[model samples]
Target: MRETSQLPAPGSGAFVFTAQEIRELDADLARRDLLELTMEHAGARVAEVIHARFPTGPVLALAGGGANGGDTFVAARHLHALGREVYVLAQGTRHELAGRMRRRLEGLCPIELLTEERLCAGLSKTRVVLDGLLGTGFVPPLREELTQWIRRINEAGKTVVSLDLPTGLPSDTAGDGSDAERVRADLTLALVGFKPGLLFSEVGEVQVLDLGVPPALLERHAHASCITPEEVRALLPRRVRGAHKGTAGRVYVLGGRPGYTGAPSLTAYGALRAGSGLVALYSRAELPRHPVESMAHRIEDWNALTALPRPDAVALGMGLGEDSVPVARRVLSWKVPVVLDADALQSELRGAGHDAVVWTPHPGEAARLLGIGTGDITRDPFAAARALQLAYGGTVVLKGGPSVIATPGALRVCLAGNPGMATGGSGDVLSGVIAALLGAGLSAPEAAIAGVYLHAAAGDRAYARLGYGLIASDIAHEVAPAWHVLHQASSEIL
Candidate 1:
């Protein structure tokens, strides 16, 4: 693992907004006395980001006719003032603050009305293109001219900096098209803050540009935060010199009948590796090798599981087959904080309200839990995660290409995992990691957030070394190294 935080804090405030949500935030902020000032602040921040990223360069600003275009113009003016050869390419009518910026930019730099021919010709000479043609409100099936321009710009392969969001990508949801159709930026400056769409793979190298939105102001408007590596590092359970087996954490992993012994063992191994001092696995006829650090106990039924001492954290359902429903019910009834996953979530929502329960489900399981189709869950994972959280009354980890963690008032997205983590036992391992955190005294939300981030970070590390061949076991083994990176990051900060 790398010995540093790959993802630094974007800002003190982190939230992923839908287009509508962003508009709402803007409206709420606009109601305050700082509307025009906010726009000005936004433009100034864009300029600052541009200058810091590529100082002293021949830069091209593709200005649209909206607020995003205004931001682009402001950046161009700033660059021009700093003695950089800045060019502004405008294609549409300038309106609102954009109109004001257009007049200002015309005084500072030549605002060229772009033809496709001119744009293609100009692209070869520019070092970087500030893409402000389309912003957060843009949707797919772009206009003919815009699409052609994006394609040409992408083909030209110049360093592109997008303002707010990449063109042709939906800000409200994940992009579902090939990269060719989307604006592939080298850097994306998220104005005011980032949204979920900006974190999409197509929107590369995101950095938050605070538009004078105070932390407290954002707190009033924002309901979600992008999980950061630094935050996860701080949330990890501290280790002491004389900490005993009981002091760290005790995690009980239960599941893995006949054909699925590996699942439970994987869960136990994950918990143990994630700083759990003692991990006990209760499996039905487990003969195959389990992690040596974890104690494996043979169990016939739920009665046998109940007979064992109540562990600090319980990981229920890896591969328990048909018995998962009863085991889940019996386990939840005991009032232990449980990380319920896989077959454990296969059953309908039941049992009295437990103090802490986390449901780790992929789209399929999430769909099943909500009685909706998997397509519905995949299409809007945020909504699905929220729905699952409301229905089941706990933190919901909606596992997907990018997992969404839904707690009561906040939703956090884990942008760490790759396609390499799509193997069978991956979710099982995640269940263990979360359980261990719960055992270590993190709140349900904190544990889910930290665990999801850690699991994805480990997968990313494993993928860096092993590529797509990374299996679930690789993810499990990489957990220790992942935590090491976090530890190294914390030490460096101190």
Candidate 2:
């Protein structure tokens, strides 16, 4: 198998556009007489990626009767020029194609009309399939004939590379609960900008390609931005040589009942590992030892929080259990930089008016807070995170396969985590990391972004060594190394 090339991190100003916005930009470029050039760039990039990634392979290009097909025809021509055996499967007859698409089709080798038998034959002979059957204009509830073809292509098991997006998937929303069948591509070449639908798992690995659209056009229509390592590096808190325990910021973790002590301990570990000067755990019951670097305190009442020395930041609600509602209320009233996770995410606490708060909730917890089903949260995490932020009046981190961090003005997606990070207590570690960053004086959004990146990067590092067997503790232990790597990279850049 050919090794996948590492996609360069998008610039900090990179923004994601909707399908309609992309179309508008396309029309705008067309008026400027740059549309054809953009299409050529897209085709060249697709062919070049296929040539580099698939190396020696017979490529079968599936073309529909649209601009998407035009791109496919151009790619097929380029692939043939590169000496690769290529086949073109056109969805319609040459007479059905129009204008640019028709001209592009005439440039290709004799194209075969798309049919079940021909598709099967093409699949059998090809090592890579380019899916140009649908682009960003696709809608849900795909036609039965197209669904059948998609199913066949998926079953064919060829390394399918989609031109813009997989066929049958809409551009507006992520997969959500749609019953429509879509082509499962191994890679998707996002033309010009990313669509929200590409954020899901079904789209596989995404590589955004520039289609020569001016950056200003994309920024004007962009709905959200992606989180990159470079952005996280810039957000990371810096420490001076003179910094000591008193100067490094203190984090107070308040959670952990009798049976769920592990959660609070992991949070403390995460805070300590993420560079908090001191971490103290205040739990309902304390019968066991915690991290050596962290102090443990047993709290009998909510009022105990009032007496405790004010820390720079606080992380609450990990395994706090059913009785945590009162404690959460008291803590929210403090108005210090706080990260609310797990049991602390109470509906009654919505809009608690904390000046600086970060809520880290998985889909289920987020649904509970929003009074909706978990499916709604999964369908469009961007909207869910935004809703959470609006309701709670703070930064919201909607944790998932690719987590969404929503601030007042921006929606950011973190794509660094892995399946191994889905283990229990993983979110507790994230909460602690965020709290640590907040304690170190970063804004809620800055801390959440940097912490989410650090936590995910650590999980990725642990996965490299321990594979699926890696646990939450492994991720916590890897935080220092992840931070060191990012810090080193940032230093080199400087």
Candidate 3:
């Protein structure tokens, strides 16, 4: 879409469209005689990905009787030409295929009619499975027959590569049904652009493949955007020559109780690592130990915040415990940008209408704020993030395996980080990272996007060295290197 020769990276910051929107775009392309060209591109890309990612083994293409089937037929032809063993199992008779699809099917030597025995036997022999059975047009409550085929595919233990999206996954809403209902893909080649349904965990590793669609056509239908490394790199603040601590921006972290001193300490270190000029931790009790570089202040009441040096941005509620509601209310009233996390999210700050505020909440906290079940939040994180942004009137970071960042007008999904980052104090570190970026002069959305990426990248770095044992402090420790790596890459690109 951007007129680049390279394939769209997984997190290319591309616009995400719904299934209906994709169909509309397809119609538009058809009107201009570009529909067939896109199909060819899609088929070629699928074959290429299968060839590159998988070893030299038989590939079974599970094709339906529609446009998706047509694509599969095209891919089968390409794979056959590439000298790879290919098998086709069509959902229906040859008569069901449309004209274009029929021509593509004719190019293949032998096509087997799909059946229970054929599907199971083909899966057992094949090293890879290409799921072109259903694309963006799939609806919920899969037919019993197709469901069984999907079950066999999942159980076959073959590397499943899906075209567009995994079969049976609704292209619009994140299906809240059981995992067995849909085809579980090991890799999904998202054609044209990402669909909202691809945000789920089941989609696996997604790589967007452009069908040479015009950017304007896609932008017209897209409702959300993916957060990319290039965008985060550009958004990161650059330090100038001879800059001092006062000029670098100050950040104040407010949280921590008797047992939860480590939470605020992590936040303070996170801020410092993220390039905060100076960081101060204000808690109810003076901690005996904290980050040596940060100042620790004991505040008896909300009024004490007035006596200290004003911060450019404030991080609230890492471990504020019971005082979160009152502290959040008081700090939110100030004009400075604030990042709300942990206990602060329990506050009744709905509709505060402060655009500078950033709310970072996990599923449980989001459920509390929205008065819904935690399952509901996890079921549709995109909707939950949007709801939180609408209710709190700021950027909302819905933290999960893959976090979603929502603003008043935009939605961004960050596909970084690992399962190792799921350890304790991770969100607190994120809160401080975002707070530091806000203080360093990025807009609320910019800071949230860049900060989220940086935090995830740091977690990945830590995970690489420490494996699953990496803690939140390890993430904070890697922030400097992560920032340096991003900065270096940004400089090279510029």
lDDT string for model 2 (1-494, tens) is 11112222433334677788888887888788887888888888999999999999799999887778878888888888898888899876342222365466565566888998999999999999999998876766787889889989999989999998888888877674343488888889988777888775355677888766777877777778778788788888889989999788899999999989999999998999999999999988882857989999887876767888789999999989986678777777777899999998889887674758999999999999999998888878888999999899889999987788999888887767777787898999999999999999999989988998899889888988997788998999999999998888744452
Please, what are the lDDT tens digits per residue for candidate 1 over residues 1-494?
A: 11122233422336666777777777787788676677777777777777887876688889877777877877788778778898888867646767877777787788889789878877988998888898876766788888898899899988888888877677776677467677888777777666766554445677777776777767666647778778888899997889899988899988888877889888887898788989988878673878988888887666877567888999988888778887888888878889998888864654433658999999998888888898778767888889888878878899986788899877888767787788889988999999999999898999999999889889988988998789988898899899887878744452
- Estimate the TM-score of every prediction: 0.88, 0.92, 0.91
Query: What's the CA RMSD for each of the models?
Result: 3.4, 3.2, 4.0
Candidate 3 least-lDDT 10 residues = 1-10
For residue 122, what is the lDDT in candidate 1? 77
Per-residue CA lDDT of candidate 3, range 1-494, in tens? 01111123334657788877888888888888888888888888899889988859999998887778878888888888899999898866352333466466565656888999999888888999999999876766778999888888988888999898889888866666567878888888888877877765456677888777888888776767778788888888988998999878799999998888889999988999999999989999776667999999887787777666668999998888989878787777777899999998874778653888889999999999999999889877888899888878889999986788998888888766877898999888999999999999998998999999899889878978998899999999899999898888744452
Clash pairs (backbone) in predicted model 3 = none
**Number of the candidate with higher TM-score, 1 or 3:** 3
Residue 226 accuracy (lDDT) in model 2: 76
Better of 1 and 2 by lDDT: 2
Q: Give all candidates' CA lDDT scores.
A: 0.80, 0.83, 0.83
